[model samples]
Target: MVRLQNPVLKKELKLRFRSFKSFSAIIFYLLTLLVFTVGFFLVVTDFKGKGFIGPEMNVVLFTMLTFVQLSLVLFMTPGLTAGAISTEREKQTLNILLTTSQTSWQIIFGKLTSSISYLLLLLLAGMPISSVVFLFGGISPSDFVLTYAYMIVILIALASIGILMSTLIRKTIVAMITTYGIMLFLTVMTAFFVFVTLSVQTGFDGSELGGQKPFSYFFMAINPLIHMASVIYPEVSESALTVTSMDLPLWVTHISFYVIITVLCLWIATKNIRVNMK
Candidate 1:
């Protein structure tokens, strides 16, 4: 059984809260979410028109909030975790950690959980406002769960990427940038690549209009955003062939890719930390 008594996690959690920058970041994040949600609400209710929101708008509102929150998660989680190990190395404290009773894997997992704990705070704090969609009554509990569950999976995958980069790179800033660059490749470049490829094959206007090739499905499978869109609209598979020729849903492939990434990245990180031990 995995142990929950990680001293490193406890220590980092304490220090994170004690830091002024951490508090300020939390405050700023919450304020931005609050204001954005309020403005959305005002616009939805039609400040000059309907003065009230209807149930029909629930899906639209939830879609907007979900995508916005997902974007924030993608942006913030990498920053928080990309410095996890590299920051310690910068302070010459990683040697201290290496000498501790904790295994390198323990250290890796501990730092990861501590960093994700802060991200959890941001996600949970935003929930009440996002829940306004639930009150209006179009989004089912199952839909909500699927969307967020995939999000958590994506965060774990991204966090693992950050941890691996943090382990490999000596400079925290460089590691952070590299981690985000990888994220950009996964999220944006992959999508663009598929689009350009499709355009070339089918023509820009799709005048020839050949069916989607299997190669396109591969890109869509790797992209978190595309899968998240599938989750939002079940009908998407009907349109995009679930971004794959396979019978399984696109999310199944999306999650499978992320799971492999998380495990592979963590394994590489643990191995690196062990190899560098002096």
Candidate 2:
């Protein structure tokens, strides 16, 4: 498709690689991940007075790495895209870009891909550290595949949110703030709400529900952390794999939720750009 051949995408990639900031960001991200990874390894081996890690400890490390990456992606995607359009407007370049042969969708797609490309770099850079979990014996290639697939979807959703914010807000700083605020609500507040409601539903009775996880977890289907937890530690988050009441798999639900929300965000962003163009 002509849209797929976006000059903006090409130009963004060129500029991204030409700058040292991209390299610095990757180095910093990898260092942070490695530091935590080593901490996990030490905690597992030293706390247990064992010189070597077991398979279970390896799974623990894998889960820790998954969540660590999740945290990074959740916080980083917004900043990567929150200024995609707003920065252009701030520099008085958005109008010029809009007037180009590039369609609104193409422009949005280009910016979105460029932002995610950098995120992919960070993901790749952390692979060696994550791979260490395999040395102790517990992760499967399928698990890594599933986890990365989930991560890509989450990043797309978050980046779309940021671009939508950039499209709606005029100032880059304001857009960034607004995007982070929304991301915080979705990622943190949703989990808190689900936990509170489930705890109340259980009413501290350990045996009332026959030990089944409450359907309240369905409320967190849109949450990336919950999805990652399910993929990385399925035994611990089996409730996230299905809604017994609905007869539907959670992965299906998760992907559907993300896709619908991403489409809505991008559609609204395109409309905002169209209006601005007129």
Candidate 3:
């Protein structure tokens, strides 16, 4: 429990909230979402000649906002956490920090959670703007809940990756770039790989290793966007989606993978910190 009560977390939170930049960023972030939502709504409604855009409109808006939020989180998370440790080391504060009462795990957890907390705050701030989806009549409370929960899982994975990169790299810039590189590889490259594989399989014999959609879908599960898309897509059956060989929602596999990666990254970061402390 004491490890959870990390001084680093408290300090980071205090400094973050006290800064005008954080407030401004949150405001700007929400405003940006608002503008996009309104712009999309205007275009759809106006072009349709004042007719109801139907339930599909709500799905479209929800999906667009989900992707937008995912992009923001993916891009912003590294910058927030990638400097968490390297910056301290760069400032020659690592030894000082190491000598404190906090253990390496505590320090790592603190920095990780503090960074994520800020990101979570930004996401929650935009919640009201996203809630406009409710007015359109396609999305439900469960959808919002699951989507936001999935987002938190994504944030944790990204933040952990950033923290691990920060701990391993001595330079903040390198750490930041490396973090983004890994994030991009996961977010973009995986999708491309999956798309290519599916396309090739479809073009060849209309069969993927013997007519299995789940096999290709496994690659889709590797990408968070795909999981989110499946969850957000109006046509996808939520209650009936089981993994190829398991009795669980396909998104469950993605969640488990993310959780495992998050834990591994954090564990490695703690180990790195311990090594540095010596």
Alpha-carbon RMSD of each model: 2.5, 3.1, 3.0
lDDT agreement of model 2 with the native: 0.81
Better of 1 and 3 by TM-score: 1
Candidate 3: TM-score? 0.89
* Model 1 stretches astray by more than 4 angstroms: 1-4, 48-50, 203-212, 242-246, 276-278
Count clashes in each candidate, considering only residues at least 3 apart in sequence or on different chains.
Answer: 0, 0, 0
Model 1, 210-274: lDDT tens per residue?
55566677787788888888888878766667333446556777878889999999999999985
TM-score of each: 0.91, 0.88, 0.89
Ranking by TM-score: 1, 3, 2
Over all chains combined, what TM-score does candidate 1 have? 0.91
lDDT by residue (190-276, candidate 3, tens digit) is 889777766765645664343445645666676877788878873443422432332456676788889999999999999887554
Tens-digit per-residue lDDT, 90-134, candidate 2: 999988998899998889989999999999888878888888866
Q: List the residue pairs that clash in candidate 1.
A: none
Error of 1 at 53 (Å): 2.3
Sorting all predicted structures by lDDT, with the top scorer first, yields: 1, 3, 2
Cα error of candidate 2 at position 180, Å: 1.0
